[model samples]
Target chain A: MITREEINNIALLSKLFVAENEMESFRTDMEQMMQFAQCVADADTANINTDDTASSSPMRQDKIGTSLTVQEALANTDASCDGYFVVKKNG
Target chain B: MGRIEQIHSLLCKKDISCRELTEEYLNAIQRDNPELFAYVTVTAQEALTAADKIDRQIAQGGDIGMLSGVPMSIKDNISTRGIRTTCCSKMLADYTPVYDASVWSKLKNSGAVLLGKANMDEFAMGSTGENSCFGASSNPYNTALVSGGSSGGSAVSVSANLAVYSLGTDTGGSVRQPASFCGVVGLKPTYGAVSRYGLVAFASSLDQIGPMASTVEDVSLVFDSIAGGDVLDSTCNRDYKPDTYKTLKDDIKGRTVGIIRQFADNNSISPEVKSSMNEAVKTFEDLGAKVIMVDIPEILRSVPVYCVISCAEASSNLARFDGIRYGYRAQGDFMSIHQLICKSRSEGFGKEVKRRIMMGTNVLSSDKCSFYYDKARALRQALSNEFSRAFSQCDVIIAPTAPTPAFVKNRVVADPTVLYMEDMCTVCTNLASLPAVSLPCGYSAQGLPIGMQIIGDKFSESLILNMAYKFQQATDFMRTSDWGVKL
Candidate 1:
C-alpha cells in the first residue's frame, strides 16, 4: 500500500494538484493500481534480452521544409507575445 | 459485394450522387446522435462540400478513388486542421491543430467525406468509454451497456451505420474491444505499419490508428488508404505494402491456427465467450484449417506489464499540456508557473487520466524505476519472444477479444483494477508489436455481440485480414445484428 505522502510527492513530480476532497479516493485508487502493477516485480525476466530492433520505422531525410506559420502555431494559445508564447511569472 | 464496393459502384454508375449519400448520413446523425452521443462534432457542411467536389469530378469523367465521397468519422485524437481534436479531455477541449494527422490527410486526399469527430476516452485512457468528459457513448446494441472504449464513439458510429466506416486508434484494445461489443470489424495494424504523425500521443510505442467498419472488406479499403510511411512520423514503416484489399478473398485452406489454451479455460472466460471460441474453432476446422492449442504463460502477465509501460509513457506524453501554450487553462492567481501547470492539469484532466498519470509517475520515480519500470520492459521483451515462438507453430493466434461481452456501465468504475483486467487478451498483441483484428463471431445469450480476435505476426496484416475475411464469410454475425440505426 502507498502512503498519502508518497501520493503527494508523485503529484508534485507530475505537476498535478489533487483537490482536498478527492485526495483520499485518489490515494486509494493509486494504491490499488500499484498493487496491480506489482505483478511485474514477480515476473521471471532472467536472461530476457530486450529486443531494441523489434519494430522501427526508417528515419526521414534531415531537411527543413514547410513548417507551421507563427500565426498558425500561436492560434490556440491563451496568451502570446511578439512571436512567443506567454506564461505567468513566479512571485 | 461489400458495402464500400457497392457504394463505389453506385457512384461510378451515377446511380447515387455523392451529395445524396452525404445527406443521408447527415440526416442519420441528426436523428440518432442525440441518444447515441457517438459524435462530438458533425461536419455536415464540409461533408456536403466534399461530396459536391466528387460529383463534379464524376461529371468530368475523371477517376475517383475507392473511398471517394464515403462518409466516415475520425476519432477526435487524430488531428484535423481547423477541426477541434479534443481527446475528449478538457485539457485539449479547444485545441485544433494547424495541420492534419497523416491518416486524416490520406483519407481526405482520397476524397472521403468527413462526417464528424467521434468521442473517445480522455487521452485514450479508459476501457469502457465512460472516462470522456463528453459523456460516455452508449452501445448501439444496448443503450444500457458500454461501447467498450477508448474508441467507443468510433465503434458506435460504425455499428449504428451513422457513417460507413470510421478511424480509431488502438493502444491496447481500444479499437478491438469496442468493435467487438458493437459487432463491427476493427483492425489494429502492426506497430509502425501506419504513421502516427498527428495523433495525440498516449503511449508512443503502442499506439496505432486502425479502421472500424461493418465489414472486413471496408476495413481493408480504409487500411489500404491510410497505411504506409510519412516523413513527419519517422516511426512509420516505409517498406510496408498495404496490398491486403486485393487479395482479401483468398482461401484459408491448409492454414494452421493456434488457440491459446488459457483463453478457453472456464475460470477466466465467460461461458458465452468460451462457446463462441469453440464455434470459431469449428468454423476454422470446417474451412479446412488445422487448429492446435498453444500456451504462452507470459500472456497472463500482460495486463500488469501494459499498465506499467503505458502509464509511464502516458505520464511523459501528457506532460506537454501545461497552461502556457494551448488548451484549457485554469482561471486563478498562482505564485509560480509550476503552480499554474499543476492547477491546469488538476482541473483539466478527468479522474482516470489523473490516476494513470500519478501511477505512471510513481512507477517511473527514481526509487521505483529499476524495480518496476525496467522489469516491465524486460518482461515485455520476454512476452514478445514467446509470441514469436508461438507464431512459428501457427500462422495466427485466436482468442476472445475480452473475457466477456460489454458489462453494464458504472459497474466496474469504482474498481479501476477490474476495468484494467479487461485488456488481458488484447494487450499482449500490443506488447508484441503485432497486428490483430477483432470481428463479430457470435452473440451473447442476452443478444450482445462477442468478438473473436485473430492475431498475426509482425507486419502480417494481409494474412490476418485474409483469415478474418474468411471467418466473416462463413458467419453472419456482422449482417445479423439488427441494432443499426435506420436512416
Candidate 2:
C-alpha cells in the first residue's frame, strides 16, 4: 500500500516539493495507481530471456553533421564562465 | 462519409475551395477550442497562406499531392519550422525550431495545410495530458474526461473535428492509447516506416510518427503521404516499400487472425474493453477471415521490460534539457552552472517528466544497468522472436488498445506505476516494433467509447487497415460524431 511518507520520498526523488496539505490525497491516489500497476506486474515473463545479448552502445555514427558553438551552447544557461556552463555544488 | 473520399470528391468537383475549407477549420478552432485546449497553437495565418498556394496549384492543373488542401494538426513534440515546438513543457515553451521535421516538410510539400500544434504530455512522458505544464487537454466527447495522451491534443482535435487528421508519435503507445480514448483511428506504423527526423525523442528506438484521424481510410491516406524513407532518419530503411493501403480492400479469403490469450487478471482489463475485443472477434469472423487463438508467451513479460528500457532511453534522451539551450531557464542570484542545470530542469519540467527521468537515470546507472536495462533489452529480443512465431500461426493479432475508458480530468491515480499501466495493452506492439492501429469498436456500459487494437507483421499496415476498415464498415461505431457522455 502507498503511504504519505512514501509519496513524500518519491516527490523528493522527483525534485518536486509537494505541499504538506496534499500528502494524504497523494497517498490515496498512489494506492490506486499501485493496484493498477500490479496488474501489469502480474504478466508472466518466466521463460523469456532477460540478459543483454543486444548492443548496449549508442547507434549514432561518429560522423559530424552539425555542431553548436560553445558560445551558442552556453547562451541560454543561467550561469556561465569562460565558455562553460557553471552549476552549484551539491552535498 | 468516408473522410478521404469526401476530400477527394470536393477537390475533384472544385465544389469547396481549399482556402474556404482552411478558413472554416480555423473558424471552428476559434469557436470551440477556448475551453478544449486541443490545440496549443493554431497557425491560422500560416495555414491560410498554404491553402492559397494549394488553390493556385489546383487551378493551374498541376500534379497536386494526395493530401493537397487537407488541413491537419501535429503533436507539439514534432518540430514545425519557425514555430514553438514546446512538447507542452515549460522548459521549451519559448523555443522555436529553426528547421522542420521531415514529416512536416513532406506534408507541406504535399500542399497540406498546417492547422496547428496540438498539446501533449510534457516531453511525451505522461499517459494523460494532465502532465503538461500549459494545461490538461479535455476530451471533446466529454470535457470532464481526459483526452488520453501523451498525444492527447492530437487525438482530441481529430475527434472534435478540429482537423482532418493529426500526427502523433507512439513510444510505448502514446499515440494509440489516446486515439482509443478519443475514439479515433490511431496508427503506430512498423518501426522505421516513418522518419523520426523532427520528432522530439521520448524513446528513440521505439518512437514513430503516425496518423490519427476520424476514419481508417483517412488514417491510411495520411500514412501514405508521410511514410517512406528519409536520409535524415538512419533507422529508416529506404529499401522496403510496402504496397499502398488502398490495396488492402482486395479479398483476404484465406487470411487468418489471432486472438491473444488472456494473460493478465480479469480485473486488469475492464469489462468494457473485453466486450469490445470480443465483438471485434465476431466482426472479423463475419468478414470471412479465420480467427485463431495464438499464445506467444513473451508478451507476458513485455510490460516490465518496456518500463525499464523506455525509462533508460528517456533518461538519455532528456539529458539535453539542461538550461544551456533555448528553453526555460530559472534564475537565482548565486548559482553555478551545475546548479543551473539541475535547477532549470527541476523547475522547468513538470512532475511526471521528472519522475520518469529519475527512474530512467536510476535504471541506467552502472550498478543497476545489468539488473534492469540489460534484462529489459534481452526481453525485448525475446518478445520480437515471439511475435515472429505468432505470425507463423496467424497473419495478425487482436487486442484492446487500452484497458479502460478515458478517466475524468485529474481522476487518474497519482502513482507513477498506475500511470505506467495505462500503456500495458499497447506497449507490446511497440516492443515488437509492429504495425498496429486502434479503432473505435464498442462503448462502456456508461456509453464511453472503447477501442480495439489490430496488430500486423512489420510493414503490413495494409492488412491491418483492411481489417479495421471492414470492422468500421460493419458497425455503427465509426459513423457517429456524437459520444455524448463523460466518465
Please, what are the lDDT tens digits per residue for candidate 2 over residues B1-487? 5675687668757888888888888888897778788899989999999888888878888766668888889999998877879989899988787778999998888788898999998888877788888899998778899889989999988888888899998998988999988889999999989999989998988899999998888888888888888878878867666655667576666679898885433478987788778888888888888998888676766677777778778877888876665677778743455556667777788766765665666556566566667666766887888788999999889888888999888864546676777888888988888999999999887677898888999999888888888778889886355421110
How do the residues A12-83 of candidate 1 rate in per-residue lDDT, one tens digit apiece? 999998778888999889888888888897766678887673545465568878888899989998889999
TM-score of chain B of each: 0.98, 0.96
lDDT per residue (tens digit) for residues B312-403 in model 1: 99999999999788988988888889988999999999988998989899999998998899999999888888888999899999999999
The RMSD (Cα, Å) of candidate 1 is: 1.4
Per-prediction TM-score to the true structure, in the order listed: 0.98, 0.87
Model 1 C-alpha lDDT versus the unseen true structure: 0.90
- Relative to the true structure, candidate 2 reaches a TM of 0.87
Q: Determine which window of 10 residues in candidate 2 chain A has minimal summed lDDT.
A: A33-42
Best by TM-score: 1
Off by over 4 Å in 2: A1-91, B263-265, B412-414, B482-487
